[model samples]
Target: MQPSPLAAPDASWYDIPGVRLVGAIAGALFLVAAIRAMFGRK
Candidate 1:
């Protein structure tokens, strides 16, 4: 049976270019923070 429209999952959010851009920026920031914390750098 097919799922109803309201019950279906929407993936349109990932289709936007800005979503990927923001995700990349956030990931980079997280990595930077993690590295800094690991080496005890301010």
Candidate 2:
């Protein structure tokens, strides 16, 4: 049988330095903006 197509996630995916926090904060802000836009809030 062929092995499962999905392999375990790479450990290095979590090893990024410095930019992780910035990316997370930016992502959160983007989500907030998206939600507000969707709800037509000021």
Candidate with maximal lDDT: 1
Clash tally for model 1: 0
Please list the Cα RMSD from the true structure of every candidate, rounded to 1 decimal place. 4.1, 6.2
Query: What is the per-residue lDDT of model 2 for residues 1-42, given as tens digits with 9 covering 90 to 100?
Result: 775667555646557676788889999999999998999775
Best by TM-score: 1
Q: How do all models score by TM-score? A: 0.63, 0.54
- Candidate 2 lDDT: 0.79
The segments of candidate 1 whose C-alpha lies over 4 angstroms from its true place after superposition are 1-11
lDDT of 1 at 29: 97
Candidate 2 Cα deviation (angstroms), residue 40:
3.6
Candidate 1 RMSD to the real structure: 4.1
Encode model 1's per-residue lDDT on 1-42: one tens digit a residue: 988887537658678679989999999999999988999665
Candidate 2 regions exceeding 4 Å error are 1-16
Could you tell me how far off, in angstroms, the CA of residue 19 lies in candidate 1 after the best superposition?
Answer: 0.2
